[model samples]
Target: MTDLVQQAGIKLDATASSPEEAVDICGKLLVELGAITSSYADAMWEREQIFPSAIGMGFAIPHGTDESRAHVIFDQLVFVRLAKPISWADDEVTCVLGIASQGDGHVELLGNLAEMIQDEDKLAILQNSDNPEEIAQLLLGND
Candidate 1:
């Protein structure tokens, strides 16, 4: 998972004015790494059109829908911390966590991430951390 984080790349204090741009930044990295096809990014955007990905508490997990799984080459996560918050539905999002996974594997990853981010202190630490390795460690841990 740490390898996935490293390979997918982490953007701290990224300059994206909107949630779309933020998700795109992370999605493009996954495309560059061949973890997912370009269409997967489109799927994410489409999914957002149907409903916002922002799960609240300043974080948004941008991901493709079930139909878009065909574009995924592997399971991966891309973290992006925006320089400014963007409106995502009813909430404001300053962090975007892009998830790409083949088949049903993402369910578990999403569950774990949800649990991890539920801790306000942990989320605050993640938002403040400047080091990618440290952020990855906080997310992936010793697993």
Candidate 2:
């Protein structure tokens, strides 16, 4: 939990207009939370074109790796909750995970997050939680 807290923060949205809009909104939150550089937001949008971050199961994981950005080892992680469903592939996602990584090390972290996200039980726990800290602890097994 401490590890995730060290890297990511959570933000609330009173109203998230749409799925694409949610991605843009989440990127802004990551920048404002200091989890990622503001410039990296562009890279994230580009990546979204090649691959949809909407991994289904009410989750969307977006990432960006640009040299112009901070390019830190741990990168950054941020959670975004939408007021309504957003189109992703054939599904609608409500929670978004905005991630930014600089090097190969992040692959392992990303894999772990991906696995955790795939688990229906885990995802349920996270969605039902009130804040990111609880979700982080759930993922980190800090509880």
State which candidate has the highest lDDT: 1
Task: Tell me how many residue pairs clash in candidate 1.
Answer: 0
Candidate 1 lDDT over 1-143, as tens digits, reads: 54556623677888888777887897897887778999998898888888888997788988898899999988888888988888888998888888888766566666767877787777777778787777777777532
TM-score of 1: 0.90
Q: Model 2 over residues 49-70: C-alpha lDDT tens digits?
A: 7788787677888777456356
Alpha-carbon local distance difference test for all models:
0.80, 0.66
Cand. 1 Cα-lDDT: 0.80
Q: Would you estimate the TM-scores of all the predictions?
A: 0.90, 0.77
CA RMSD (A), model 1: 1.8
